[model samples]
Each structure stands twice: as structure tokens, then as C-alpha cells.
Target: MNWKNTTRQTLGTTVLCLAALAATAASAATQQMVSVKGSTLNMRSGPGTHTEVLWELKRGYPLKVLARKGRWLQVIDFEKDRGWVARSLTGSTPHHVVKSRVANMRSGPGTQHRIVGKVEYGEVLRTREKRADWVRVERDSGKIGWIAKRLLWGW
Candidate 1:
């Protein structure tokens, strides 16, 4: 084979390899939602101007993007429910959950305080801190409160 012809073939092959690598890198750069904030987000059946509403998502909601088409994103929520939504409405904050049955979350640390909420087993809880047996938690709508230490998983 001529040296000049061999050099051109090698250069062409290298360019193709580099192009494939760049495409893979670009695919991996898309941002993922670490958590969901606010009261709730609406999930729609399809992307864009016309779609049916499927479900509502509360705070600390988690989702994985399956694909993206223009300004809309196809995702699977924490419940593994698949749907589409506007890409600008999601966030990336960490979340946790309660690990015990009938966990009492109170207004204060001591048992003397009023019971503010009752967290069931496997219920998700956003953690803040711990004071003795109390674990501070933040609700999906930004409600700050405390729960018993025996009630949570991430503590």
C-alpha cells in the first residue's frame, strides 16, 4: 500500500473514534434530579402543549430521566411511575425516610410536647438534625419539625 493512502485511512479512523467518544460524553452530562421540592409537581401523559395529567408528586420526590425531547423530559418517579414534565421544574436535593412503624413526630423533643404528625413505616422523611431522642425533619412544603430517633433510617 502507498504510504500517503495509509496515512489518510488512519486519520479517518481516528476522527470517527473521537466523534463517538464525544457523543457518549455529551449523553452522560445531562443533569439528574436529586430530590423534589415544593408541594407537588404534575406529571403528564405526553410532552409539550397537549397532554393529559397523570399524577402529582410531593416534596422529596425522586425521578430518573428516561429521555428528553426538546423542552420536555420523560421520567420515572420514585414510585416507578413513568410520565413527562417540563425540564425546568425539577431539582437535585438529597432525601431520606422513616424506618419504623407508627413513628411519632412531635412539635418538641420531649414526650410532653404535642404530637404533630404520625409517620408510618417506610414513609419518607427529610432529615435536618438530632437532639437526644428527637430527629428534626423538614416536610416537602418546608415544614420544620421533630420526630423520634427510633423512627428514622438515615439518622
Candidate 2:
């Protein structure tokens, strides 16, 4: 091959490799919350309905999406449990689960804010807003307050 053709071929190969790398980085950076929209969403050992059911998740339950495969999503919960669920059963609405024992719910998004309530370990709360390192959450029990981001698990 001529020198010019060789250079062009090398450049095309480099561009293709770079594109693949970028796609992988984008997938790895994706961390989003998905809530169970159905009354009962089945978590499976594999990414299909034919797979063995690992468990059943109730409506409003939130999961952190790790990856996706066709119509299935590989997810992880606050307990660090990993499973696959049908994408149709989940929504993009954000939610959070208390990871720390007795996480203080504050009137504002900081330590200076008065403690409005306390969330026990494994408490699931709907995400209302986010400010800096704090997240505003509303419990299903009608309690609303802000908690430190690190004390909870979600997107």
C-alpha cells in the first residue's frame, strides 16, 4: 500500500477505537433511579421473564440501574442486592432508601437545619429535590425532610 493510504487506514482505526471507548465510558457513567411502576415487579436472576424469579418488588420501590439489556435492566437496591427486572415495569421517577441507621431528617439541607425526623435503616423515601450534598425526601408516611446524600442510596 502507498504511504498516504497506510496513514489514512491507521487514522480510521484510531477513530473507531476512540468511539468505542467513549461509548463504554458513557455506559459506565450512567447511574439513574428507576421506580417500580407495576403493583409487583419480578426481579429475576437473569435478564428475561423465563429466568428464575429472585424476588418481587412492590410498587414505588426504587432501584439503581447498573446496566441494560434489551427490555431488561440490571439493578441494585439499597441493600446492595443486584437483580434484573423488565424495563416496562420501572419508571424514571427518582427515589431514595436510607442506608444509615437512624438518618436524621432535617428542615433544611444541612447539619445546621433542625432535625425534623429520623429515618430508620431501609426506609424508602421519594426524592423531592436535591441541593449540594443533601437530598430532600418525602416518606410514604407523610414525613418530609432533607437528609445527607451519603446516608442514603439512590441515583
Candidate 3:
């Protein structure tokens, strides 16, 4: 029998399987939002509700999915905090959260534009557009304005 040939073929198959798994994991690195049901999403230390709650994420908060278990997603925020959230409570909508102490919302994409409003830390805003380093954002009240991308996090 061709023992060496069989071993070589098995090794090649193993490499291909690993590559496919790597690609799947890369694609799983998607941004998702906590579904807005007039409540907060509990990020837990483990995949189950029996685990300790690490944090409570509000609606519109953006999270990067790092891994997934049965019905739960291992997620990380703009602050680099990691936790597990129920997959059913997340959505595909694009959003951003204010990471700085305060973010100035302007009428235009640059600082020369008029200041339209202000958003504080932990506040979440829907992503509207991007111009240079400025990101146009919309508040829950339907107001639209631009903020410097450096002052916020998420897509």
C-alpha cells in the first residue's frame, strides 16, 4: 500500500480545512447592534443567562462579534471590553457610540461648521455618512449632525 501517499493527502486536507475555518472566523468579525426594545442588553461573563452580568449595553451600541456559541455571541466594544450577548438580541444595523467625554455635533463635516448639538459619553448614534474624519450621525430624536470620527467608536 502507498502509506506515504495517504499521509500526504491527509495533511493537505487538514491544511485546507484549517484555512476554511480561518476564513469563517474572519467573516464572523461583524459589527452588530443591541436591538432597541426600550431596554438594555445584558452582556454576561459566559454564554448563558446563569452567568454573571458584566455590563448592560443600550440600544444602538455597536459591538464586534469575536466568536459565537450556541445562541450567544462573544463580543467586544469600542472600549475593548469583552463579554457574551444573546444573539437574538442583536441586529445588523450600523451605529456608533460616543467614547469621549463629549462630542460636538456640527452642521457640516468640518469644525468650521456651526455647532448643532452635543453628545455625551456612552450615548449611541446611528451612522449616517462619513466625510473625511467627520462622521454624520443621527440621534434618537431624528436630529442629524456631524461629529469627528476620532471622538467616537464603532462603524
Candidate 4:
């Protein structure tokens, strides 16, 4: 209840808050997204073709690039599946994967809009534009709509 103690507590709280914000910003700035460029891109345990294949990612599959080797890149997907892929098989196209079991693709950026299509879990959609918490997405079939950002995990 003394002035000194109150000021010290306030300063400690301020420092902790600033530290948290800095960490968040740093991580956000470092994160980069890339998409699978081929029909089937093999994700390996190591950064080369000789390594064990961990997953077969389809074209447009969004991956968070974590690190890079000579000709390969370490990546993680929406499901937290981590592996290495060839840099040539990836591109800078932005995309998102449905993290939820299912998400409604709406005509607009809110629930008020009519549902145009349904997106399934692990399904990748090309990112078009962002409006508030909703993102405009394009299905591979050529259908375009808006989906709530909370239901997706990607760029």
C-alpha cells in the first residue's frame, strides 16, 4: 500500500507486458508462408531426397517455412506436421487450410451472408483478400467465397 511498492509493481507489470508484445511481434515478423507448387510434393525427415518421406502434400497446400538448407526448406502444416521439402517444389502463393472439421464458405465476410460451399478439414484454399476476421478464399474448383479466419490455419 506504500507509494514505492505500488510504483515498483506497476513498473514490473509494464515490463512484462512489453516483453510479451515484443516476442509476439518478433515471431510474427519471422514467420513466412509458402505453398506446394507441384501436384505432389514430398515432405522428408531431412532436407534432401535421400531422407525418409514423411508426407505427400498436394499443390496449393500451405506450409509455414521454418528454416532452409541448400535446396530444401523445413516446414510445418496446419496440423503441426513438420518436415522438410524441396525449395523448388514450393512457391510464395498464399493459401489457408481448414483447421476445423468443416467450415462454411459464405458469400460475404459474415454469417449474414449465404453459404456458398463447405470446406473440409485439411482442405487448402487460395487466399484472395481479407476483411476484418473473415478472408476471401478461392476453392480449386473455381468457387470463391469468404470464410471465417478462426476456422483456418495458414497465411
Candidate 5:
């Protein structure tokens, strides 16, 4: 084969390989999930042989996967906390369901406070702040008040 043809073929192959590697890296960085069952799940710094306790997760916890290193997965919780958990303990679960139904948005934490407006199911509320169990949500009409976070899911 001519040197020119050989060089051209080698360069093309190198480009293809580089492209494939880049694609793989990009997909790995994308966020994913590993299911957690039972009452609590432990978070560690490394995959196997826990060295530190990052946090504990309750049942029906959906974690955001940061990356996978061997048999362990780096995950983040709802509050944006990061840690590592074993891949064996994580899997897919379809039983979890979050209800969109919301009753009323009050000015304060309890129902005794003045009612600003009522929020129905499937309506998305923008959370502005949180005060203990109560979260301040922005309504569709631009009204804001405290709502119980426990009343809904996927906040």
C-alpha cells in the first residue's frame, strides 16, 4: 500500500476512535438513578467497604447518580447531598408514586393562618423558601405562601 493511503486510513481510524470515546464519556456524565428500598440506606465515600458515613436514606428514595466506579455508584439526594452507595443496593422500582394533589396555600405554617389561595392537583408550584416543615410556594397568580411539603411529593 502507498504511504499516503496508509496514513490517511490510520488518521480516519484514530478520529473514529476518539469520537467514540468522547460519546461514552458524555453519556457517563449524564445523571441517572439507583433505587433504594427498606427503611434506611447508608451512603459511603467509596464503593465497597464503607469508610465514612455520608448520610442515611429512607425508603422510596430516588438518588441522582453522579458516576459509577466499579461496583459503587456516586449519588446525590434530594437536598443535593453527595455520597456513594453500593450498586447492589440500587435498582429500579415502579411502586413509588408522588401525588400532585395540594389542598390550600396558607400565609403561615398551620391552617389557622389566613388562606391565600387553593392549589389543585397537577399544578406546579415554585418553591421559594422553606421554614421547617413548611415551604413557601409561588402560585399561578403570583401569590406566595407556606405549604406543607409532606402533603406532596417530587418537590
Candidate 6:
């Protein structure tokens, strides 16, 4: 038997398996909502409180998690702001952000309904309800309206 040949084949197969596992993990990155849990959540330049504070976030803010380390998470918001936040401040609650330059907010779940208002690009909305292709949402200012699901990210 060729021992060297067997070892080489086994090593190649292990490398391939590790590569596949990495790809799967990359695709599984979860989108979640920032729930500061009372005290304001501080976003830092790095993964620890000792790092510089980039900004502060309130509860229910939405973010897409790109990576995690210990108790910190690297996140991006609707305005493309990127920073590190404490993992304890986030949850799996679904949220959406306006992707279009201006999303027309209708009174109801369809275009036939009255045009209630408009939201600029990067505006974040909390998911209240969903009906077919439209999602009912409430803005930071407490304005409620419906927007086409396709016009936003995170569904």
C-alpha cells in the first residue's frame, strides 16, 4: 500500500470540507434588531468598551450582523454605518430599511390606497405586520404606513 498517497488524499479532502463549511457559515450570517435593553447601546470602533465610541443606538434599532467575536458583534445599519456593538444588545426580531430613493407610504397595503407620506432612502422602519407583498411599518416619528416589500431590505 502507498501510505504517502493515502495521507495526501485525506488531507485534500479535509481541506475541501473546511472550505465548504466556511462558505455555509458565511451565508448564514443573521440579520437582527438592536435591543439596547434600557441603557443606550454604545457602538465602538472595536469589539470592547475600551475602544472609541463611534456612536450610540437606542432599543429596537435594526442592524445586519457581519461577524461576531466573544461578546461583540460587527454590524451595519440602514445608512451604511458600520461599527461594533455588544452581542447582548441584539435580537432576532425582523426589521426593514428603505432601499429606494423615496418610498411612497400608503394608507393601506396597496397602491390604490391614499398616499399617506414618503420615507427617504436609508430610513429605518419597525415591522408591525405583513400582508402579501406589502409590510406595515412604523417610523421613528410614530408614522404608520405600508410599503412594498421589494423596496426595502431585511423583508
Per-model root-mean-square deviation over C-alphas: 7.8, 3.1, 4.2, 5.2, 11.0, 4.1
Comparing candidate 3 with candidate 4, which one achieves the higher TM-score?
Answer: 4
Ranking by lDDT: 4, 2, 3, 6, 1, 5
lDDT of 4 by residue, 1-93 (tens): 999999999999999999999989768744988999889899999998899999889999999988878998888988889999999999998
Which sections of candidate 5 miss by over 4 Å?
A: 1-30, 94-155
Worst lDDT run of 10 residues, candidate 1, spans 29-38
Please report, as a residue range, the 10-residue window in candidate 2 with the lowest summed lDDT. 24-33
- Tens digits of per-residue lDDT, candidate 1, 1-155, equal 99999999999999999999998876764435434556677789999647888987676665667788888888875455789877777665555566565777788887898888777765667767778877788875666678877666442
Q: Which stretches of candidate 1 lie over 4 Å from their true place?
A: 29-31, 96-122, 125-155
Whichever of 4 and 6 has more lDDT, that candidate is: 4
Tens-digit per-residue lDDT, 41-147, candidate 2: 99999998899999898767889888889999999888888999999999977888888888999999899999999899877788999999999999988889999
lDDT per model, in order? 0.72, 0.89, 0.87, 0.92, 0.69, 0.81
Q: Using lDDT as the measure, which candidate wins? A: 4
Evaluate residue 108 in candidate 1 and report its C-alpha lDDT on the 0 to 100 scale.
Answer: 85
Point out the worst 10-residue segment of candidate 5 by lDDT: 93-102
Residue pairs clashing in model 3 are none
Candidate 6 clashing pairs?
none
lDDT of 5 at 10: 100
Candidate 6's residue-wise lDDT over 24-143, tens digit each? 877776544454443468889999988999988765667778788999999887678889998977775666878899999999999999989999886768888999999999887899
Model 6, position 16, has a per-residue lDDT of 100
Off by over 4 Å in 4: 1-30
Q: What is candidate 3's lDDT per residue for 1-155, written digit by digit as tens?
A: 49999999999999999999998767756544443333579999999999999998888888888788999988888889999999888887778899999989999999999999999998999999987899999999999999999998877
Question: Judged by lDDT against the true structure, how good is candidate 1?
Answer: 0.72
* Displacement of the residue 89 alpha carbon in candidate 2, Å: 0.6
